[model samples]
Target: MTSGAPSDWYRWIPEQISARDYELLPEDFCRTIEVVDGHIVKCESPSRLHNRVARRIATHMEAGRKPEPCLMVDTDVDVRISDVPLSLRRPDVIVYRCLDDDAKLYAGDTVLVVEVVSPDSSFHTDTVEKKAAYAAAGIPVYLIVFLTEAADGIELIEEYRLSEGRYHLVCLHTRRLTVDSPIPVDIAFGDLASG
Candidate 1:
């Protein structure tokens, strides 16, 4: 019996997929796509600046976080928002509860989700669509970081908290970000862009 090459195993994916189907996809393939409303959406590679900002933010958050809740901070991780229609989003940086076993991270487990605005990102998609989705999923906090015009650094960080089943702007930090919700966070904006 002759076995086919690994490439031969590749098959055309359907336009829509369930959460279970998504879970079955190869880990490499899953890194390049996100599921929205049961549909497959390819994710564009983020710019270096975008990645840097996210990493820096996650590092700072991890340092400032309280140890009582035993939260875990991560970058570029899938967050399951819904199961019925299967919606998932990969947040640039996420603060979630530490789990005992290796398992999927759901929206309910998320304490805060951060999205860094990339040069190619659509304003509506980040500010409107994702904002609404995270709020609907009952995520406690959402942070949107806007890059500078030159695309070299962070310009503003808008923190939104869920209230009355909706997100209300809590603060817009331009220089340094300081917040005490879900956990205490204090990060100097300059440090985020600096080498």
Candidate 2:
């Protein structure tokens, strides 16, 4: 995990296995899996609340985008953390400049990436490591919607922007998030937990 590799969780799975190989595995009963640093990392299934929040944020973003430059889906893509690293990550949501239908979207084309902290999962992976990875890949904006163990359900939303090959905190809010870079966005965290 120091330089190029992560934890040895999948140490026995072999180092040369590709993403295709991970896909061919006989199905994981519970977890969502991805190949990171040539290791198969299993992510815990997101709780219904977690998914609901993510969906609301996505919906809100779609509703709030404006007319200057049409921010399209740019196609859902598996982003490589870096050109040399073998990380293929699927962010919860991503948006960028609208391009041809057939164009393949890469990290360089990303304008924003959102990650919602899952209630049933360890939120560690979404913090520094993934944010660093995304920043390292030159993605402009990164947002993390925190859904922690709090009485109100939604905890806080943290926004980070890439600056000088690294990410720096722009703002943190508990009720709402408004971002104006890479594409404007206004989201209400309270709406996410409401039925």
Candidate 3:
């Protein structure tokens, strides 16, 4: 195996960056990186199918969302988990409260977070690491979308709810996703697939 230090712009990156300082980074540069414990972690570009599923889910959630809570659905946005050590994650889809100003979103503002499992994604990171982090951040709901064996579309969705400072498996939806907490949402897996 060939091994060498990262070259070019990567070499110039500092060992760690605070959440506040991370915001000062170039928008384009910040788009492809996530901060974990103040360290920069490069994010891989997800497949088109992954993006499509996330977008469809977001669309469905927005359409069925209730008006009372005043929530917003967005895709690929950073949710700051902590600032002291600077832990942040860019979830595939996020449901957050409507903010007055266009500022950074904190975990407290988040209602639900979704992560679509791509062929190249690490199962442990999606199911364990991110789940634990989101729970610790006090996000109420977490969804993990599993792709079909053929990688053509969504196959299953595991919904978890935070209880007593930890997430518990609340529901599993294979054909149709329906959830009541955080907001009522109903989305068919078939609709999330590309034609």
Top candidate by TM-score? 1
Q: Per-residue lDDT for 68-175 in model 1, tens only? A: 878989999899999979999999999899975569899999989999987466466789989999999999999999888643377888999999999999899988
Evaluate all candidate structures by whole-model CA lDDT and list the values in order.
0.84, 0.69, 0.84
lDDT tens digits, residue span 45-91, model 2 = 67777777777767777877786687764212455553333566777
C-alpha lDDT of candidate 1 relative to the true structure? 0.84
As a whole number from 0 to 100, the lDDT of residue 190 in candidate 2 is 63
Q: Please say which candidate is ahead in lDDT: 1 or 2.
A: 1
Show where candidate 3 strays beyond 4 Å: 1-12, 150-152
Q: What stretches of model 1 exceed 4 Å from their correct place?
A: 1-10, 150-152
RMSD of each: 3.2, 6.6, 5.3
Write the residue-wise lDDT of candidate 3 on 85-190 in tens digits.
9999999999999986578799999999999987566577899889999999999999999987543477789999999999999899988889887777776787
Give the range of the ten consecutive residues with the poorest summed lDDT in model 3. Answer: 1-10
Clashes of 2: 0
TM-score of 3: 0.90
Could you tell me which residue pairs clash in candidate 1? Answer: none
